[model samples]
Each structure stands twice: as structure tokens, then as C-alpha cells.
Target: MKINKFLLGAFALSVGFASCSNEEPIKGDNGGATDGEKYVTVRINSVGDIGSRAATDNDDFEGPAEGSSEGNVTKENIRFYFFTADGMPFVMSQTGVNGTVNTNMVKPDALNVSNTNGDEKTSLEAVLVLGAPEKYVGNRPAIMFCVANATDEAAFEQFAKKRLDAIPDIEVNTPGEWSKFRMTSSTYKEGEGEGAKVIYYTDISDNVKDTKDAAMANPANIYLERLAAKMRVKGLGEYTVMEKNEDGTLATAQYKIRDENGTTITALKVNLLGWEPYMTANSCYAVKNIDKTWTNTSLFNGWNNADLHRCYWALAPGIVSPNNNTIPLYDNNKFKYGNYDGNKPTENIVYTYENTSYQPASVTDRSTKATAILVKAVVKLEGSDEGIDMVEWGSDYFTLEYFKAIVVEAYNADKDVTNQATAKDVVLKKNTGADARSNTWYATVKGDDFKRFSNISWWQNGITSYFVNVEHLGSKYGVVRNHIYDYTFNNVVGLGVPGDDPVNPQDPKPSYLAARVHVLNWHVVSNSTILQ
Candidate 1:
């Protein structure tokens, strides 16, 4: 059985404009009538568009599918922060805010922008008072950061106080830690995406006029990115057996199964049960980060959007220490599972922190890990009212009773007699050796101890599971923040690996699942890449 999966971003970008009056400036303790105080109005875009060709290759993009654009780009609120050229928090005139002198953080009310076309594009216009303006008399402030819809002011207050480089290193213990907090660079510099969203004052200094009216006319623009990545699964249609022709085209074939008597069963059915995410990260950083030394530079071809200065790679939490072995299998919020037949709109869509690993040397290597989807499915055969529970060995499938019976038959033939008990012992050894007469290996025809003797996997109720790795564009293995991974299975080659253990799944046999993939840049509508 082969499974084809596709990765798509369902959220598209739209354009909405909001503005703040320049007549009034924030004359608080931080930026009052201080001699060095300077104020600038910034036009902020909190949503990402599929048409921007930012961090994606979709230049001629249209928009997202109907009803697919949810609350992806809606900016309910806004937060503003300023930093020095050296990447430290600009000290505020007050001493006791957020436990630091950086009382410069601003929480503006939600703006009511006109969504003329109902595209869900949200924007914010805020007057950012540059403290110690005299310090940057002729020069521009280093950069500014914008956050949207961050409701937990107390939790995010800690993050807002940290320096730029330190932000990405901060650990978010759980996936639900302040869910709506978003961070994006104000300036897209060379190494900007790796750390903080640094919107450089120099990059937009040309618009930093002395007066608020002058600055508002040509204000700086910055895009905010969410700290989490989304994943969704849909049953495209009934599962089919697919094969490649000599010309590289695909051909469909019906799957065949044989009964105990070796009679081919013409009637077979496969059903889509449910799915869950496996090997996913338990935590992540507040800001996205990446490894600069990754040798596969091609993996990053479209990773960085020149227009937006956003990088797609984020080093997930626990990746640095390499203790990401434990998967939260029971966490309903993160490891979501739901029943959806093929082509249903009710499948569960979940979010995850960025998770990645170095490309393993072999298929069996487990030292490094990446996030993969655990698909649960069952196969039904004719004449069997229940799903068939079978075990696979070498290249064939058999029920536990049938498998043991075959071994017993071979043992009796070798001994030239049906010694029953004597032959059963040797056949149960899980492995056959030179000492074939040993009567120590014991196994019953039932489920209990037989599995201990045989190394074969046992599928319960014919439940076959496939662990499909989530692929990003290029050769890298990981899921990045602000992107959506949509998976659709296209083929199935064999009875999948036995057992329904989503936590620790066995490696699939060669070609058990076949895939073809395509990744396009994100823009106005939800973007999708195919994995066949």
C-alpha cells in the first residue's frame, strides 16, 4: 500500500489598512518631552499573503480556496517594542515596568480596518516614541519589533524584555504557552530571521521624518509571523494501489489477497480510520531560529524571502539538547486524532512547534528524529466479518495461527512424524537454529506468549499503521513555523507495519508507501505542495 501526502498552506494574505492620528504623541515617562525623544508612526501588517512571494516562489499567486481562510491573519491586538542598534532593550525613563527599565513596550487597542473584500487582512498604525531621541539625532534607531494578538501580557512581558538573539533560545515548555503571541522582524537583515524579527531603523530611516505627519505619510511596514506551524490531514478519496509505468506515468491496480487455501480473494476494502502526529516536539522557542552551518544550502533556496526577510527554519525546543525522544502520545491538544472517512471536511487540524533533525544515514537510524504523521487504517477481506489481524514475514502475510501451523508442518516433515508437542517447541523458537530438537521454546495459538517467541509484528483487527514523515521543501527534514502541512494519501503498497502504537512505530518496508511532492511559495490563499 502506498500513501501520497500533500503539504498545503490554507491561509492566504489580504490587504487591509489602518491608521493612527499623528497629532498626539505618547508623552509618557518613557518618551515625554525628553530632549532626545523622537516619535515615528509605523504601518504594520500582521497577516501574510500568498501573493507576496515572500519566503515562497509563488509570484503569480491568486488567493486561497473558499471557506479555507479562517482566523489565520486576523490581528486582534498589537504590541510594539524598540531596541538599540546593539540589540538590547532600549532603557525606558521609568524603572519599574515588566521588572526592568524597558517600560517602552506599547499595547495598542485592536484596529478596525475595512475588510472591503473580506480577505481577512489586518493592519495596525501606531506612534512609536523613540526614547532618548537625542542619542539618535541624525541616525535611526536600530530596529523595532511588532507582536499581534498576544493576550497574555504577563507571560509575554518576559519575552519583550529580552535581547534579540536571546529570544529564539528561550524555551516554551508547552505548545499552549500564550498561544496567540506572534513575533516578526521589523527589518529583514542578513541574519535577521535566525534570531528576532529586526526591522532595522536604517532600512526605513528614509521615512523617519522629524514630524509625525511626515513619518505617517511614508511609514515603515513589518509583517508578523506566528510561533507555531499548522498541520492538517484529509482523506482525498478511497485508497488505491498505484504503480509507476515504464514511462514514469502512474497506473492504478486493485490489491489482491489470498485466503488460507491460497485462493485469491477478489473483494477487498480499505477504510480511513484516524491519524495522529508522532515524534513531534513538546516545546518550542518564542522566536524562530536556524542552523547557519547546514551543508545542504539548496534546502534553503526559497527558505528566505528576499522581499519579507523571513527564514523558514526554526530550531525547535529540545533539539539542542537532543532529549526529544519522548512523544506526548496522550496529549489531546498536541497529539490530535479523529475519525474522518475519505473526502471529509471535519478532519482535525493541529498546530505544532517546529521540529527537525539531521538527515539520518539509513532508514533505520533513530538517533535524530523529525515530526511524522501516524496514520491509522484497517483492511477488510471477503468472507471475514471483522478486520483481519495478520502478521507479515519476509514477503507474505499470515494470521498468527496460520503462521505457527506452517512452521509446525515443516517441523513435522523434518522429523518424519507428526510429533505435535516436540515439533511445536522447536518451531516456536522465533528463530530456527542447528539445535532443532530443543523443547524449551513454548507458544500458544493465542495472543499472549506467542508474540514473545516470534519477532513478527501483530496487527490487531487488521489495523495497519503508516508513519509518514512530514517533508519541507528540498532535502531538509522538519516542519517550520507559520506554514501549514496538508497531507493526502495517494497509494498503499502492502499491509502497513503491524500494530497501532503511534508513539514507537516500526519502519515501513520498502515502497510500502509511495509519494510525490511539490512545494510552492505562500501567498494570498492557502498554499499547497504535493507529496505523491
Candidate 2:
């Protein structure tokens, strides 16, 4: 059921979703400032998180009883919001529209997530500021939600305010459940859809019980989940930065994605359609359906093989593109969603760019395995999306929903999905001549070979070109630590992987961290240039 058409209170069924947001109300967590308020430390993607690891390509967990785990979450740009019993301000309803958003309800500073570690203090959160007892309107409870960036925040509010009863619609058919998420990778720098929504509820009766019910000043904790995947490209060629030189020169080049400001991006959209992430038959609730009467726990369980195939063969639970809904799914497959029996496959949706005139491209299950993440990059200069390269990486399942592994064992050693160690479909890019993978095999004096690797570039060639899998790209030989390197330099120098590997394997000076590139310049090579 599209969240836009639904009522409120749909999130409990694990259906309604919203984008991330923030403005200013309380300041005691990450930012500087505090009003001596008791802050609720909410952790996102904690252990046993709803989105967890699976068999292959982070595929759904198995068994008769569908269960879930706390999967890892890496935020690039995130924002969240909290509303009191009082419904969200109508002004804050529709973002980037006729009215303005109530920034006061949001954090003064947005959560600028580069690599958000859900377990660490970095992911800590609290309400902006304890809302006025009057502000905490309703007698029921308050709401908490997270979205990708600013655009999503506006869209969510706009829809919520329109509902007549209980604004910010928390009812079963509320707009929250109807909220559309960007399930696929981002095609442009601005990002694709409003992204996904992760929301929860916290009782605030103590804060808004009676007119005199005050003194309940505290920041609440809120956990968020990404309904949509995140993917972007780096603007430099395929070179991993191994280390920085004494004179400030790059010893080796590696693939580390950066933003317009040249900041090292630790994570990208791994997978929006994550493993066992509330899918088919369980994706949501059908308030109007007379057949299967479902509940919250029973629905948002996980994905099963039967449902997986059904999702793949379906048209979609929602629209493919948020902006442009034309060019419907050609698969002509249909399934059930809510009360409808001909519901389209939600996973089959596409992630295209407005720059491409909303022309849908191959970011689908039929075309490639790495359907989850799209590496968006500005290859020309800095601060410009002129030459954006939207490249795909990951396996075919769940579109292999976003891969966020650094130095991960990404080889399909068994060659197929058999013993599924690392994404079973992920093949080792066969490097030739100097950069061959077999060279990384090291035989110690003990007659034992320990395969070591550096932050090397692993390319994934698609309709776009050869894009690097930064997560698995490591060095074959290295004690060289993590160092920042400039991509535009003529000498793409890495620490140990010298300018010339023919004579001696170039290794850089020692350091605590391994190689890393602060900035990136990507080159999406044509099919002819593919190494493998």
C-alpha cells in the first residue's frame, strides 16, 4: 500500500515509512549545548537490528519461522525528527512547498553522517527540546522518525498535515504507511526518491497528561531503518590510496569515495531491499483485505524464498520512481498487496535520474546482481555533478542491497552460491600482468601461504562502465597505513604498491590505519576495458 494513500498508525505493521530529518529543540548529544535535560540515548541498527546478515548477498534469513537480526547501518547524510502529542505543525507538513517547515521541531544542526556506527556514541540521538506540554498535543503518544535528507522531511510533513483527524497521520491508513521509499540506488547527486523512513513511537503522557503535567523535560531515543538503498560514485579513476608520503605525496592510490568537499566517505547505500527486511506477504498490512487478517509482528517478519520469487515476478507494491511514475514495469508480473491481488513487485522498481529525463535504466533484478547501491560521482571538478557516474556493485539478490564492507572477503571462492562465504556472486576481478590476484598469495618460511591484500580496486562493469568496489578493494602487500591521497596527481603513488611494481613491490611507511583516499576521481571504463 502506497503510504500517500493510507491513513495513520500503519508503522506498527512495519509498513509506513518516512525520510530522516532534524532542526533544533534540544542540544545535549553530539552538538554543543545543553539545558540540563535527561536525554534518551537511542541507538540505530544495534545488534539484532531488524536488518541483519543472511546466506548470500545479505539475502533473507531462512527457516519456517521468519526472524530478523540487527544488521549494520552506515549513514552518509541523515536527518530525524520527533513530535509531541500535538500533531506535527501543518506548516512542517509539505517540505519545499507553499509553506515552511517548523525547523524548531527539528535539530538546529542536521546529523551529517559520513560513516555512522550504530553501536558507538556517534549514532546517539534525543528529542530537539522537550516540547511544551501544549506542543505535545495528543493524549496517545508522540512519534519519532528518520529520513535521508531534507527533501524527504518536507514530503512527509506535507502529507501528514493534510489528514483531517490526528494530523501527522498515525492511523492505519495514514500517509505515513503510504510514504514511498527509494528502494534502489541513487542516480543523481541530489539522490533519487525521498529515501526510506524508519519510525517508532514513545509514550509522552507524562509530558502531555494534563494542562499542569509539566516537568517531564527529557530527550527521547529514536531508532531508524533505511527502507531505501544508498549508492554513489567517486569522481577519480580506479586507484586505491595506500599511504601518504613524507613530503606529502601519495605512495599508492586507492578507491575511497568522497563528497564535494573531498571528505572520505566510509559508507554508501549497501542495500535498500535488505535481507529478511519485511518483504512480500509481510511487507505491510492490508487494512482493506478480507482474506489474510495480519498483525504487526506477523507481517514485518522477514522474506522467504517463495515470497522472494513472488516479489521478483511482481510489478510493484509502489511506484518505481517517486518523481516520474511513467514507464511502468515491463515484466507484466503481478501479485497481491493489501486488498489487491494484482499488486506489482516492490523490488522491481527502478532508480533513474531526473537529469536523464526520468528515463529508466537498468538498476533492476533482471539486469545485474549489484542492484542495491549506485555510486554517484562528480568526475570533472569538485562541487559539481556535471559528470556523474552511477555505477552498480554487489550481488543480484536483494539487489545485494548496498555493500558496506571495508577489507571484506568478497571472493566467491567456491565460484558459485554453494558454500556462500562472501556474497556468492561477487567474483574476483582477474587482474593481469602486474596487478594479478595470484601474486597476493604469500608463502611464509613455515611452508604455509597466507593470502594478504591491500586496499586495491575491484571493478564492476555495467552499462555505465568499470566501477570500483571500494568495500573490498585492498592492497595485496601492505604494512602501509591509511593515508589520504589526491586523485588528480600525475603520479598515482600508493605506499607499498610503488609507481612501478615491476621491480619491487612499493610499500609505504608504517602507520596504525591502512590505506584510504580522502578524495576520489572515477573512470567508468567501457566493456572493452574490463580486466576480467
Using lDDT, give the best candidate's number.
Answer: 1
Candidate 1 residues 1-532, lDDT tens each?
0000001222111111112123433333442221222345455443344335433344322222223332333323445565666666654543112112235455533333333225433332223333443432233344566554444556457657667566556666443543343444422335433553433222344544555555545556555565556666655333543444668555553444333677353544455466666566766666656655432364555555546555555556555433234333233343346632334432465566667655544322233567766655666665455677555554456665566666556544544443443323433323234532111233443223443344455555665555566677655667776666655555654445543232333344432344433222222112222222
Please, what are the lDDT tens digits per residue for candidate 2 over residues 431-480?
34465432122111122221332223221211111111112112110000
TM-score of each: 0.67, 0.28
Report the lDDT of model 1 for residue 487.
Answer: 59
